[model samples]
Target: MIESISRRKLTVTQQLSASFLLVILIGSLLLSLPLMHNSNAPATTYLDHLFNTVSMVCVTGLSVVPVSQAYNGLGQLTAMLLMQIGGLGLVTLVSLSYYSLKQKMTLSDQSLLQSALSRSNSSGLRPYLFFIYKLTFCLEGVAALILMIDFIPRFGWGHGIFNSLFLAVSAFCNAGFDNFSTTSLTAYATNPIVNITVAFLIIAGGLGFANWLDLVRRFKAYWLEKPRHFKLAFQPLSIHTRLVLYTTATILLLGTVSGWLLELNNPGTLARLNPFQQGMVSFFQSVTMRTAGFATIDYQAANKSTNLLYMLQMIIGGAPGGTAGGIKVTVAALIFLLFKSELKGQKQVVFRNRSIPQALIRQTLTILIFFFLALLSGYFLLLITEPKLDSFSLLFEAISALATVGVSMDVTPNLSTAGRFIIMALMFFGRVGPITVLLSLLNKPEKNIRYAETDLTIA
Candidate 1:
């Protein structure tokens, strides 16, 4: 057991996972302090606080208690900090601190950062890290300004500015925990200013740092061109960047259009609004449903079809290396292409005239299968633990937990201890990724042994 522990300790992924767990435990203790909650509200339990800490640290918005009622100003700030760290990642944050302090990173530090961001090793890692922070804060600052346009007039200056900043960070992190009472963004469902700003933040954050770096490079080349050369032909994007953009756009379009059509006559959601308002709400929900947890409509009252659609969307999620979490857009796209190629009887799946490696296909399928397995396992556990809860609600909760998209069907708070524990484990696995967690458990291969291949027939 000690040898196994020692071996696992040497893995970068395991270390990172341990770091997050440590952070959550510490944050839970901090949040459980009596000072964190309002004096009039009931005393917050350690379990509830731990759940909130995991949710924030995972950037999953699931909560056993409403943010506004459970937390005072300090607790809210602590939650935001946790989300920021989770979104940026612990390694990125440490790297930035080192950069600020003029300290050189060791090889081990670089490896950890690379693993966390899933970025290829580069000589310019430090510069890229700086760029990430610069871009993140800049986007959040702009978003805060736009949000304040609505918040200020309603809540006044002091409260509005704080709320604006909080919301901006939450949106950018794709962390849906909001301090604005129970309804989330429902109050601003028709408010284009708030909806558009939050939606923009979420999308921008979900595009992933690598895609942003590619865009920046392209922009720089174009900007530096001479007037005569301004008509310069653009270089094509990298395959990864192109795939992420295409899949993201496709999902957003499909979700928005389908949501509009599906919920058009559903009274509690999109039906009561005018055409323009309905369009705005549809677009917002489409954006949020992918990863962000904010809801413009009461999803509990939404149709079963819409709920099912959201489950699929949550599973698909946003781009990798981004604030959003799920199976990842690239994996989803690859799986779709794999199906397309299979149906065409092609031995190789090709995208953009390039044949994808078999290893990648296998990896994608493995991740998807593990996700479903975890979801099924958690759903069954929830059914056993919370027998009174309906299957649909339990399944929805399980999916939400595993996808790290915390849009609950009014069932999260009411869950029993065992159910919460199951959800918490699912949240951790979802954020860290099932493949990652599995990989962390694995030690270096002692030897590579070739085995004869065997095939099994299927229907």
Candidate 2:
């Protein structure tokens, strides 16, 4: 009986892990269709299809081919649909839609949803799932409508509307694929309407789904409903939300300032732009570094300091349960909390008046270890495959792709086939999650007897 139970558990875990990979495989096959391939270009290679598939499914914006020049409307739409599915998360979306259709959610379904959304098993899962679906679609619609202003005049009514919708979805999903590769939005870099609109959409998307819902619930109850004085009940923000907002703001401000200072004198990059343009580009770069992947300036031409700053931002990506990937803001915050507690000689890790479970702390450390290992392993592979590329640029590209941040230093397209494959695997692992993937592959331990306690000395 025990052996059978263990086997069933292992099987379930394996199936769960395979779900994301299977989706990526299917997406790649569909995108590789002749109609979806660039009409004016050569036949698509397996490597190209795989890389694009992972990038889209992961919602990471790194692409070897210029999106506008490479694929047709059908292809771009396919990519956008993949991004939408990825952004909302496969399991969460399926569960919410299932519930909306008046279907019952099974225990397994609830577990998957909770894991996907990073919610506690004891929390009210159904209502939260519904809120996530409703809030995400509503926000995407608003962002699309706002983006149409700049898109319509340029691309005309039909194409403009379509592009606007696509870009809005892309931005809000934190997928940085743009339709303006030929014209390259370089013309509108200074346009406040375009820049600010994109920035807002990106921020809204980067802020996790839970935070969006929490903000909405509180706003409606406090302001719109106008409850009795001294009876205003505000929903407290979760520790995840607090960490995400605080860390995101800190990274963005620091990244912007550092990018500006580093590139202000670089004649090839930011030197030619006026102060207003320079600042706008700097701010956009800062925002995009956190998994949005859009770039106003050529990342390759960016100085070493700017690239390093971006790598840091990519490593500490958006909040949990959001489309954006990385180690996650909460994980980073927990690490800091753990460190602070250690310094203060506290017994437990606490933040925002909430105590973090010890399991979560261990998980965070494991994630950090896996992340660094994946990054370093990918970098080393790249070094072997493409010896000509500079070490820093290669490392930046590896980390960006691994974090699914999509802020490449422009070495993506130039990578050899082997190098691209390595990145494709990294993107997939990063998106599906390091812990999930690792647990899926490992065997469950059998408990027979307790081991004798022992202590080891360490520095």
Candidate 3:
């Protein structure tokens, strides 16, 4: 025990979890201060602040209190800073600090940073990380400026500038915590500028930094006429980028079309709007489902079919190595390919003529399996804890927490203490990932021993 307390090293996952826990605790304490709340702020417990801090740090937008009513300007800014840090990730920001200070990173630090960014090659990791930071801040700044166009006259310079910047970061981070009251973006359901700007930021952030880097490289290669053919130029992109793009496009298209069709005649959702606004709203909602929490329509009043659609969409979320959450689009794509290959009686799972390794397939399956296990566990636990709440809504809340999507069904504020704690666990696991958390606890390697194979009947 004494030795354990001495100077010791931590694995990447442990470092990540510890850094995040530190931020969450510190943010919780600061935000819980009386100075952070408004003069007439609603009463709240330390648990409320902790839960909010966890949600913010996890980039899950679920909240037990209306941010505007409970907190003053300082608190809102603090929350925004939390979202920014969470979205960029602590590892990323720390690396930026090191780089800015002209400090050489140790090999261990480099490895940890690469792992955090889901990057493979360490040779160009620093450049790639810097590129990500530049792209993120640049996009956020542009979106903020655009948002101010609509926000200034409506909210005035002081509130407008701050709100614009806040929402821009929130949307880009996919954090979804809004100061616009408890209704989220429902009041701006038909506001095209707001919807389009927010949706664009969501997509840009959700695409993942690695994919963006690949795209930039391919574009530069094509522009210089090296291998001239666009196809050949982009051929250098990793299979991961291709799958993420394909899956993201497919999900967005399908989600938008299905949502439009499902909500066509439903007065509670898009029925009251014009066809154009309905289309816009449908598209926005589809984008938001990729871990962006803003909701133009009241999901509670939405069609049951739409609710089911959202749950499925929320589970198959945006690309990995970005602000977005859930099992990730790559996992969904791989699982689908795995099934398709098996159904076709193919010897190997192939995508784009390249067969995926068994190890990666196994990893994908592990992630999916653990994800569902956590989701289901949280759902059942919520049912037991919040027995009086609507079962469907409770299930939605559970999925939202576990996916780190933060889209609640008006069930968050009324949650009991146990329910909030359960949600917090789910949120933490969701953001850090089930495998990551498990790996932190049980990180030792197993003996490389094999046993004789045995067969079992499928039927």
Candidate 4:
């Protein structure tokens, strides 16, 4: 298999998988340097450094130690840079640098972007990529300024500005990393400025990048056509954008309500807060639980129902082509639609008067199965590696890492060496995507001969 792969040119999937792995290894090396550690902090093994680097580059945020306790300022900046590279695709960044230099695209770079976006050609790829980069940095900058209002007043100029920028990047990358404290953002549970700013960054970054571009184009077209007549003209949104928006809104509303109700009477979690404050925290929890991974309340203190709900949300995650992970919102929505059509005894799956192609339905199921298997395999491995840990917490941690959600029931710090390795593997799989990784390794050729089809027994 190795010989065959070496002889053949690598496909786009293989290149992307290789690129991410390369970044992870390089990041681990950087984090292992002695200068990366705090002088007052205890010595760390290369294993710990690798683990931390993997967590940062994957944007999974499952650290064995609090970031502040582990590293100094330069170290934190390195980690932040890892999050940026991972959140923005490594290949995409390379393409961006080429654009900056006004260089013609290499065949490999053009092929990579085309495959990444599933576009037929590269005609509009340049403009689309530029828009995504500009939008991402602009949003992060705005969010950092907003957060400075809260952080600068408390930490003084230097620390405050750095903290604000770090958090803004972390939030917008949907990374759970916080230099604030070991508990993530618990200190600012009821602080409106922190909660709103962080939540906005997460949502904006999680919303599919293409969706934003689509919205902008539609807005421009509508305004340009306004002078044609007194009547207003609105462009129809793409089905992908419509589905993402609807699924996101529904999940947010349901998650907020479920969290609020689940923790209403639990003094350990949200019961101590006034009703208005509880609402604020509940909304933030809903926003972060779906793969953003920041925490306002102690998740372990909450009822079992809330944790269960969050795991489901984590599995659903954010949109495609976005910083967030998991199978993604569109995949979840398509699966639901697939089931609805099947239960209704309809031959075709339909959404918004548009009949879904069979190819898309199959692709959606394939993605779901890949993620499901990864989650289960990771959970079982964690069980074997850390038998002393609570089975429920182990399962929770597995889902968190595999979905790249990063929330835990305080299970991360106590993870055995083997357990930490397992979580790191899961985080990488979640970021690069299980299917993409698997496909990259296989050397099999397509079978042209077809066998006779037969129907299976129905349940």
Candidate 5:
């Protein structure tokens, strides 16, 4: 029975992986049409179109061509739709559709939804789906309103409103696809309104739906007048939620301060800005590092230390079940705690006074190893494909693609066709995950024979 269930789960994960690939393929075809290109812009190759589509659908946001120059109004709109669908998993949209039609979800559907959303269970799936849609739109609506406050006056109503809508969705979805073509958030680097609004949107989206739902429930319970309700309200957050929140806050804080310090004297990036502007850029980049791909300054022009810093941040990425991608903040935190515990000679790994299962630790280790291997393999392949590229930037690009954090050092556009294809594969694997891809290809075979345990030596 247990083996059957494991195989079933692996099947579900495979389905999810296949679903994302299909979405990207369809999106690429749509984007490759001649009608999608701007009138004055040069026609884009199918490979470029495929790369862009995968980047957008995966919500990684790296592009070979500047978005404004590569596509017309129609292409831009299509890209936005793809970003929304990708950021919110396909299962999420499907569940919403079923709820809208007043249809019940089958057991298989529930299992897929649970797996996609990384939820603990499928109880109250409908309400959760409803909440996700409501929260997403609400946040995007507010972000758009705030962004329009500045864009409308400068670009006029039509362009301003459109830009506001696109950016709000991009930020909230952590897609990082800026229509600005050239400058990105650099133009608004010192603008408190745009920076603060976008930062909030990125952080909120990266928090994951589960965290928001838990926070809302806890908040409502705390305000309840009934003793029973109050008692429920005062209950502490789940270990997952707490760990995500704590680790996210710590990452943002450290990233911001470190980025600011590293770039303070470098005239190429932040040194020219005023103190306030520098601080804003620092804070904005920090929020964006593990999540969105928006940039206020040219990261390539920054000091080597800063580039390495950003690379590490991108590798860590955002929380699971959120729009952001990476190994996930929780996984990284758990690994840290595990290492700390081991160093202290403890047998059982514990966090927040709760013991973590050995299975989870093993899972984290497996993911880390997979991530490193993928990064290393991609780096070597990229080197062979683009022999003239710098090793540091090449490695940075590989890691960014694998983590699905789309910040680039200007190397992506110059890559060979093979390099681009390699990146597309990395982005897809990163978005879905290494384990999911592996499981999608393998059959889980059950072994009935038992073997005696053997001890292995380790350092």
Candidate 6:
């Protein structure tokens, strides 16, 4: 009976969603401990703790309190652990460990793993997961080392090491929580080592684990003195990879230029900095706006255009099946591709020389529709609950928190309890994903009788 139960089939989305929910519940309890509270043992409300816990576990850096000032060492460490687990993905870890332990992987387990990694049932999947683990550690270690150079000299070795590790995990996970204040990086805003290191780590992590796996395989094959069979052996990047890279590049470039153009005139923020520092700040903002929430400038003081640009960046966000969140880069790319294909009068939509599956297109559309609705609904609810807040800031906060982007207008802490709950739900749904949660709640669809094809035109 037990063996049969273990072998029973489950939808990949359902399993992943359930796993995330379980993690959230467990995390909430863990974070609510008195030890996790600050020195004053300030009256900790259950809902606040729950919201913060969910945010951390979702890898969304939105917080009701200033994280650096509110949490003690234990709480901070707990938050970091939650972010790492959430970023790595609960389902991916289970699947990796199952295979590593030489245990039999059930069909359900395999399906979940494939979904988590956004890969098909290819023979390379296992090796890909192993390589992902190795790649993540190596990249994170290098990022930590580079960041430590900036941190250690000013702060002592112990504090420096802690900050380095925290920042490394935070960057790789695309969680924007930073112990460093605006004042902290102000000194090193133009420091090449700090900017490049963090940027590299964020981009690498944002690229998604599947891309890392492909690059690793290609590099290993090339380095092993393998015969160069260009046409037969070379594996081109998949459609998902191409979409992510193109969209991310376009957004980053445009965001940086637009930010620079808009903010160069702001006397308090950008105008004070030298031209080089201004450019660096703009570039860093562009890179970090997507999902990594580290800010070199005070977001509250950013000009109107820059704020709007950052909000747009937060909405498009990073790639699928990775730590970063939002509607996802691929989803936005697909929408664009679909529009272009329609304009060209093409029957089928194609990306990277391959036809995108209709199911995927439908899924992407569903995600976008639900995501926008959720954001708007959350925003409206917040507006009603906290009527005193600025509408634009509230809207930005709602979308950012819901999408797990973590970019804020610096109003997170002032939100009411109801507002916090709404944001928490958004973070939870965003991290587990709309499609996954929808699938879990709805379960597998039953087959329907076939009907004659008919066309109905509207619009």
| Winning candidate number (lDDT) | 3
Per-residue lDDT tens digits of candidate 1, residues 43-72? 668999999999998888899988888888
> Could you give candidate 6's per-residue lDDT for residues 49-149 as a string of tens digits?
77777877787877765556656778778878878878887766776777788887756566667667766564667888887788888998989998888
TM-score of each: 0.94, 0.88, 0.94, 0.93, 0.92, 0.88
Q: All candidates' lDDT scores? A: 0.85, 0.77, 0.87, 0.84, 0.84, 0.76
> Residue 26 in candidate 2 has what lDDT?
83
Worst 10 residues of 1 by lDDT: 1-10
After superposition, candidate 1 runs with Cα above 4 Å error? 1-9, 226-235, 434-455
Sliding window of 10 residues with minimal summed lDDT for model 4: 1-10
Query: Residue 309's C-alpha lDDT in candidate 5?
Result: 91
Q: Which window of ten consecutive residues has the lowest lDDT sum in model 2? A: 1-10
lDDT of 5: 0.84
Residue pairs in collision within model 4: none
RMSD of each: 3.2, 4.2, 2.9, 3.4, 4.0, 3.7
RMSD (CA, Å), candidate 3 to true, equals: 2.9
lDDT of 4 by residue, 227-265 (tens): 654344333778888899899999999999999998999
Worst 10 residues of 3 by lDDT: 1-10
438 in model 5: Cα distance from truth in Å? Answer: 9.7
Misplaced by over 4 Å in model 3 are 1-7, 226-236, 434-448
Q: Which candidate number maximizes TM-score?
A: 3
Please provide, for model 5 over 1-459, each residue's C-alpha lDDT reduced to its tens digit, 9 standing for 90 to 100: 112223455578777876687788889999899888888887678899999989888888788987888888888889888899889976678777777989776688787777777776878888888898999999999889988999999889988888888998888888888875565677777899999999998899889899999898878767664556554553577788888989999999999999999999999888889998888899898888875888888878988899899988998888877898888898899899998998999998988889998767867878788888888888889989999998899988898888887888888989999999999988888888753733433325545899999999996
Candidate 2 per-residue lDDT over residues 387-410, each given as its tens digit: 998888899888888888787767
